[model samples]
Target: MPSTPSLNDLRQQQQLAFLAQKTELRIGHAHACPLPPEHLAELDEHASEVTAVLESGLTARVFQLKLAGADYALKKARPNCLVQNLDGQTSFLNELQRRAEIDALRQRHGGFSGIVPTLYGSLAQGIILSPWLSGGTLQDWDERKLIQLFASGAELCRHGLFEWDFCPGNLIDDGRQLWLFDFGYMYRFDPLTQFNSAGQGNDVPEHHLAERIETRAYFAWLLEQEQTRGQDSALAAFRLEKEIAIEAYRKLRLELGADGANGDVLGWLDGLGQQWRQALRGDGEALYWQEGWRSHRLDLDDDIRGQTCTPRTLARCDWMLNALQGNFDALRSSGALAHETIRPERGALLDHYRRLRSQAEDFQIA
Candidate 1:
């Protein structure tokens, strides 16, 4: 072990770092806890079986560890987010998670397990351990692999999260299966919130319409892809996959008890289908018309104008964009786009994102 320091000193140093940066500190989680180093050392020794597995761009560190006699995920926060002043908020989050888990158990009125990560243990507001899932990520593989990822992902909501955000960064592919990992952005809206950051709670229809809009917009794009990526033999495969996905989506939604989408959701898919047919015959204007109708039809003027710079909004957008990009890349690799000269005019879409992110507040992955 390194030189032992008083817990008070550790916290004081962390406080200085946080105020200096005007943001939370994100390094050396456990040791920075408000406990004497000797005590902290004892805690480390207790969890000595844990192994450093990965580190995030944010301050949290991932560990492959054993808890409750089995493999689990241990995420130790960086010091800044768990210092003295922030401790209340941090503890509030932790307690909410405990509640989420219990509420999830109650919600299992039948066999429904809520989207809450299984909270197995916690050490102050710093480290958390959850049951390790048997899942990986969609972005971790090829087209076929990603398709597998998306297929499994569509079922994640069945586990719990309704108005969930599955960004590429938070998703984990644990080899055998794929799992939704991060809950920092989750909030119970028309769905459920396992826990929320004390300061930033949920995104209801009022505070954050951008998340759903961005979701719809991306579906608009995927509907666009399912339209453009098809033709010849690939057409058959594309339609089959889309139909499967649509069915999965429909089933998923129905399971949630929300009223069925009154074809508004499927309409974009249908329109994209028609425009794609026209594009096949070389009338590319069909797609533009369809897309223009969507901006008006979906009332996505905010996203169209790129005003969706909030964390939730951008997170959802990133999910949709990431999927489309991966699928497109796959089509090329499968020699699916070799003879096609289809020009997907997504520059406006891309430009909208650039405009939003340029504001600098929406860049939160932490």
Candidate 2:
């Protein structure tokens, strides 16, 4: 009997073939896309149509184009992705795959409200084209934005897709609705049998929709809120987010249960919902501290591992160090360090994180 190939194995095989130019990567929704594959492939030749060039993306460059009086965003994969890891190397291909799945999901389920519509994606051509979103990245988060973001996350979860990266760079708000446009880090899993796409799925229950949102996007923004406004203001914002998350998880629990999801999966959702409910009923200060610690820690680790550390990563490091110095007892009492296999003493933990902070500074991406 043969064993199943690991995700890394599959990714390596795909990357090799893709780099060797042996794989033909072409995908599109005919009803959604106005241009044909041949035209999309030759987009760079029509430089006169380009309105703007955005080179800030790590894995791709985006061109704002005007064709026949209509605007479009054409994303071209960078010859060398800046992320510098296996996942980064194959992200463009992964995105094309997820886009196809998302398009199929939309066809079957009508549409996903918060998700951006994909026009077409071709890995071999190194381009993806979609209608231009006039909206800008989210700067200030409000109840409407929080509700919509979580609702979209829950909807994706119910459909067996787990999006890992919800950073500000990937989110947009047009004053009406939030939109998720990046699928580079999104992965598929069995919602009926797993907690997420990590490990065996249920093994890493801590990494869920809400956790991913908080770790990747919310906490960094919250860190800014804390520094600019104050601790009280940051806490208030976090409370609002939690309130929205509680409702989202509650609905997700009911929906997944109806779909006959695993007992452990449903139980996990119920536990999170109940926990948030209890915290909201009280002051929620302890809950806030615990979750904040977890989110910052996880996000910091992610940035470091990906070698994509930014100034925000350093800010998160400072947050953890401050928490350790001033609120170590609170962290312990809240069970924030319970996830650590070997309990770290205060001094050791501080030194450990300080070294990580140094590494973050060294690896700061341009």
After aligning candidate 2 to the native by TM-score, how far in Å is the CA of 330 from where it should be?
1.4
Q: For residues 1-366, could you state the per-residue lDDT of candidate 2 as single tens digits?
A: 987665446656867687688586667754555567667657673478888887768888888888788998888888888887888888888888888888889989875899887787877788888888887887889999999999999998899889999999888899999999888888778999999887667777888988999998898888899889998999999999998898899899999999999899989999998899998898888898889999999998888988999999999999999999999999989888877544556888898899999999998998
Question: Each model's RMSD to truth, in Å?
Answer: 13.9, 2.5
Residue 157, model 2: lDDT of: 89
Best lDDT among the predictions, by candidate number: 2
Model 2 lDDT-worst window of ten: 3-12
Give the whole-model CA lDDT for all candidates, comma-separated.
0.40, 0.86
Candidate 1 residues 1-366, lDDT tens each? 775554334434554454456442222334323343233323442467665466542335566665446766666555544212433224324333433554455456533232325443343445555666655433423334334434444333344333333445455665644454555433332223311222223311222222232233333334444446732333443333344444444554555345343343334334434534545455233333333233222323333233333354444345334433544444334333332233433444445535544542533333
Instruction: For model 1, state the Cα shift of residue 72 in Å.
Output: 2.5
Alpha-carbon deviation at 90 in model 1, angstroms: 7.1
Best by TM-score: 2
